[model samples]
Target chain A: MKAIIVDDERLARTELQRLLAPFKDIQVVDEAVNADDAIEKISKHQPDLIFLDIQMPGKTGFDLLEELDNVPYVIFTTAYDEYALKAFEVNALDYLLKPIEPARLESAVNRVLEKSKKEDTPELKSGKLKADDQVFVKDGERCWFVKLEDVRLLESEGNYVRLFFHDHKPLILRTLNYLDERLDPKTFFRANRKHIINLKWVENIEPWLNGGLLVKLKGGQKVEISRRQSIKFKDILSL
Target chain B: MIFSVTSVVVFTTRLLTAQDFSVGMIFANMVNISTVILLWSAIYFFIHYFENLKRSEIERLVWEAAVKDFELKTLKSQLNPHFMFNAMNSIRALIEENPERAKTALTQLSNIFRYSLRIERTETVPLEDEVKTVEDYLALEKIRYEERLNYNVEIDPAVKSIEIPPMMIQTLVENGIKHGISKYPKGGELRLKAVSVNGHAEIVISNTGSFSEEEMKNSKGFGLDNTKQRLNLLYGSKSEFNIVNDNGFVNVILKIPPGGRQNESYNS
Candidate 1:
């Protein structure tokens, strides 16, 4: 497995690289200091995996993941344990704390090798969202590992997006545009700029103001479908 | 000059009316006596009214000065050495293990200090700003407590524009952790929920910690008392605070009036 190490600290990058030297199957392709450099290196190398640091100079490791259209397997290296839950929500392979325990690091690498093997096999892209497909949402101290199907609605509030699932709503540091690209278009419909409704969760739909439509979800929350998105909603729903 | 004329008139009348000189002298003596009495009464009333006004003005000044001093001291006392000690310890742990996360934690710590120091000079900050500061503080605590301490904050976007007393919610949250969750072996959850209800903004901090009656009675932390005093000074009877224990959880509720001159002047 080919990999790249992205960390601001030279000592940290060198130490991690040295630690990985014993794994004959893993090859250290390149290293970058920050998110921009990582992006360039990642695009150039197309490595199978990345060792990401959660915090950096400008963009965070999470920010780097946000920029990617297809995220490779990631193992987050951070000293703060607070982000462990959040990193899991982002579907990180594993989170290794600083000083990098040898046993834990070996386990993370083994998991990567296993995941790569699974990816090599051909598989159908199923319509139903799986438990492994998780979205990141941070609301104060609570971060959620939300399945795409579990999320009933995505409401836009200024610069942030609110994910509504179950009884809790978490505001994530993401824009509607950012979510629009990553979400599977078939299951998640952009009802309007202000809202993205899960297609399977829509309970009823009715005509509303100015040729638009109002979509009521299984949870009984109403979302307005704009004239532009209304057409798309109808096409997807076969109305 | 007016008093002197009255006195002169009295003297002349007294001299002229040594005996019963004439009816005119008697009338003049009576007029002189009445004028003197009227002049003295006017002078006495003037002095009394002005003195009362001056006294009230001085009283108001002293009260305001005392309140300001108390607020400053309370803010300082709340964000003292203990908070720094905990934060530094967390940073120390992060520095050796996770340099990147350590850097992020450091940045967050700086933001908390900046928000706190700026608020020390302010009477009330926008509710949005206060919420942000509390979030920063909680983020730091999350680093320390890790998974043991979890929180959920739900705030209405509309209420974000409203004004609230600085450090009011932070103090409540701190107290919830210190007196409530910190004692628990497994630790517990903390939640802050804000909503606009019935022309008032209601904030509730619910934590998964139990408190006995004795503990409740003995809850004499300076942070809680300071928060109560601040609420009283800012909103008087218009704001209310209550602590309730249910099942195995403790919840603190704070309610403040929605609309008043307090909002207008605060934004200004």
Candidate 2:
């Protein structure tokens, strides 16, 4: 797995790199000094995993994750931030404290390896987000690593996009138009100007006013397909 | 019985001496004796009451001092875990890059830890010793922050021997880095200058950053608050502490009166 280490301190970055030397499967693709640098490096390499420090000069680890559309697996690295630790505990996210123990590092890497194995069945399709891909959503103090397949609906509110999955409805800073271009069209269909419905989650559909269609999701969410898209939806579904 | 006997003696004496003992004279003598007794009793009770009150007041003050001393010790001994872990990580990395410098860095880290532990033993330390500890601190931070953190210490020899509250200056300097330099992307400079002026030790710590009153009000300034409380407890209103922003630099000025307070329990 390609991994990048992000920390403001050169010593800390070098130390992490030294520790990961024994892991043959995990390749250290690059190192970033801060959040902006990490963002740039992440886009360039598209690494499968990242060893992210929670504190930096400009932006924090959470801020970096919030910016990404499809977040890679993150194993947070913090010195001893009590607030960040509480967030990680609440989310059950993996993290390694600084001066990391080799035994702990081994376990964290192994956990990520096992998770990647379960998701290996999905083929990477033309650089677009797949159903098995994970996206990080943080709301207030609560954060979750949600899979694309689990999200039943994406509703637009102003410039933010609210994702509906299970019982959570987290608003991410993204536009519905921007998400529509990135999301796999075969799985997520743009229902209207403000709503995007996951095709696999469709439960029942009924004809509605103005030749639009009212579709019910398995999770009981109702979405109205626009009159213009209903014909396209029917053609796609019937075929 | 004494009164009756005295009256009988007076009556006999008057009869034997063949003198006219009037009722007015007897009444005047009785009044004089009662007045003397009342005066004696009133003085005795007042003395005892005041002694008890004074003793209790002293005890209350002593108890308050003890509690404050315990709190100061706890506050002084609390080394920031964030700084400690980051320093350790930096030293660990240095071990492979330069063994000699890493050893020195390790020693610096140990010295800081030892200084904090020792601060619990005394309320105040010489300016010289505190400066040495601060140097060790900035040295380690310099390693962690590298070129991003720059610091200079200018201590006047006259004030080096003057004693100030332990960790007072160090805490301020740490704040300069945590809230000031660390917040900047390119980082900034930190300056610590100590001088004697008008029988008081004036220590000023300046860092490159803008202090926002709004942000400071929103977030509880833990280190700053603790330092203020500590200074108030140790020196009362005698010590001066002021923080201000001047031309994008945050300056924390602390003034300690000469011969800073000497409490037996705290000193020991």
Candidate 3:
């Protein structure tokens, strides 16, 4: 598996690389000094896993994750930040403290391998996000790795878009038009100017005034399809 | 019962001395003995009560000193594990790059840990000793921060023997690094100067960063507040602590009076 190490300290990066030398299955692709550097490298290499340091010079590891659209499997590395450690505990995520022990590193790497094996999906080369693609969303102190299939609706509010999935409606720094372009048109339908509905989650559809369609989602959210989009939706559904 | 014994003794004495059976003289002698015995008892009890009060007062003072010592120890223990782990990480890397420097770095780390542990047993340490520890601390941090951290220490020999609270200078210097130097992306310089000013050891630690009101409110109070309480406890109002943002630098000044060893006698 391709992996990247992100830490501001050169010595810390060197130490982590030395420890990972024993694990032949995991290859260190590149190193990033801070959050911005990590973001740039992550997009360039598209590593499968990252050993992230929570504290850096500019932005923290969490800030880097929040900025990513497709977040890889992450194993956090921190010195002694109790607040960051608490977040890991709540999320049940893997983390290694500094002066990392060999046994703990081995276990963390093994867990990453096991998780990747369970999710052995092919990467989409078409540049469009598929139903299997997972996006990272962080709201305040809470974070989630939400799959596109699970998202039933997305509503636009100014420059941000709010995603509805599993009783969560956390807003992300994305626009509806941008998501509509990136998402696969076969699954996600642009219901109106303000809403995008997942076709798989359409529970009830009824004709509304002015020939528009009213759609109810499985998650009990009501979305109105514009008259022009409703005709296209019926054609796509063949009804 | 004691009253009766006194009365019998007094009556026998009166009878023997008078050589006659006189009830009035015997009763008068018994009354006089009773009054003398009461006066003696009052004096004895008063002395005993006064001694007990004095002992309890001493005990209370000792207890208060113990609590203050414990507080100081706890404050010292908050030596920032973040620094510990980061230092170890640096040493691990140095092992491959420069082994000799790595060994020296290891020694420095141990020195800091040892000093922190030993400081709990004493309230104040000589300026020379504390300065050595702080130098070791800065050397290790220099390795971690590399070119980003630059520090200069100037100590006046006159104030080297003057005793100040253990880790007082070190703590302020650390604050300068944590809140000031480390905040900048390009990093900045730290200057520590210890001089004798008007019979008081005036130590000033200045770094290249701003100590704005917003950051002062946002930062955790454990380190700065702990330093304040410790200074107040050890030197009462004699010691002075002042922090301000001047130009582009944050300056922390500590004025410690000589012989600030209030808790030294408590060890016995």
Candidate 4:
């Protein structure tokens, strides 16, 4: 696995490089002190993984992810543990705290090796729509690491799912069912067969014909919840 | 009381009504003059007393707040000396085992120390700069722990521009190793995460060990408590902190109002 250590601290980069010396399969391609530097290096190296530090001089690890057109596998390294669980829920393969133990580093690297075999799989196919998770959206020349919370609506037409967020509607070649299986049910609700709406985005809900439900999302789009699903929704929400 | 006295004086006596007055009227006027002077002084005394009391109360509150702020700062500043001495001691152990690495670590240590030394000029440093210094300190520590220590940091890039008190996160990271990870034979994992919210930053420090109430209390004596106090002092009601040990992990969560570059009026 080709990897780059992105940290403002030279000693930390050096220490991580030294720790990886025994793992011959993984090569440390380069080092970046900040997010902008990492972006330039990453675009050039296009490494398999990044030993990224959350804090840097200019851009944070998050800002780096925001700038990337294609995100490599990330294993976050830092001195604090606060964002560890949240990062794990996102796309990060693993989250390691600092002073990095050799054994843990090996295991994290080994997971990356295992993951490389299945790198083609889409990220949102596995987990809930966490507030931190950034999904890749390519709309012609423009792209975004749109947070799940920012995504107001997901409408399906055939196999393509049009993701609606902040006025841009980008279509990805995936079925609504595929997204339904991955997105957090609490945040992303199947309003109907064709649409999955973020619950947090619901601004108003009213009764519709035939025991159905109408929900107005924050962005002003209205979605209908089938009577059957409404029951389940009420149960989940305990409303 | 003055209104009643004035009304009584006005109704009981006719003042300057007569061009010429007898000695009895003169004596009465003299008494009235003294009475008016006494009433005026009485009103002035009450005003002065209440004003002084309110002023003193305000002074006390300001002093108390200042003391709390200083206590937190002193606690935070103490970490550097405490950490420096410990690093020196660790280097002492490494000198004979690996001379070259020790020399390198010593230099790295100085660099890390210098990064934080700039903190005196400003209450908060850019989030990323502080993280870099912490990472430098960890590199030196890696020499001592070898394979026993592990860590990962993931911060939202949005927060890189934000400012926080220097060494706030670093202090917690050091405490995680000293109090939680170092105890177990196999050691533990430490992870740091920063997430930028709308106008604030959320920081979490987690370690792979649990602590009893007593142990947690003991650790809170200075390290974690100091962090809590400092955060409160710096951000006041805008910040919040909580520590929870659940299912074998110790987590410290801090919500700090982001002191972005746009706002420069800090040392207030």
Give Cα-based local distance difference scores for all models.
Answer: 0.75, 0.88, 0.85, 0.75
Per-residue lDDT tens digits of candidate 2, residues A114-221? Answer: 999877744433677889888888898888899999999999999999999999999999999999999999899999999999999999999999999999999888
Every model's DockQ: 0.01, 0.58, 0.46, 0.01
Q: Which stretches of model 2 miss by more than 4 angstroms?
A: A121-125, B1-77, B262-268
User: Per-residue lDDT of A194-228 in model 1, one digit per residue for the tens?
Assistant: 88888888899899999999989998899999998
Ranking by lDDT, best first? 2, 3, 1, 4
TM-score of each candidate structure, all chains considered together: 0.40, 0.83, 0.80, 0.38
Model 2 DockQ, alpha carbons vs. true complex: 0.58
- Over the full model, what C-alpha lDDT does candidate 1 score relative to the true structure? 0.75
Weakest lDDT window of 10 consecutive positions for candidate 1 chain B: B259-268
lDDT of 4 by residue, A1-239 (tens): 68899976555676777788999999999998778889899877767788887755445676677556446678888666444445455434477766677899989999888867754433433334455465666554444556677889999989889999888898876789988986777688898899999888889889888888899988789999999888887787776
DockQ of 4: 0.01
Model 3 stretches astray by more than 4 angstroms? A121-125, B1-73, B261-268
Clashing pairs in 3: none
Instruction: Name the lDDT value of residue B226 in candidate 1.
Output: 70
| Pairwise DockQ winner, candidates 1 and 3 | 3
The TM-score, computed over Cα atoms with residue i paired to residue i, of candidate 4 is: 0.38
Which numbered prediction scores highest in DockQ against the true structure? 2
Among the numbered candidates, top lDDT falls to: 2
Q: Is candidate 3 or candidate 4 better by lDDT?
A: 3
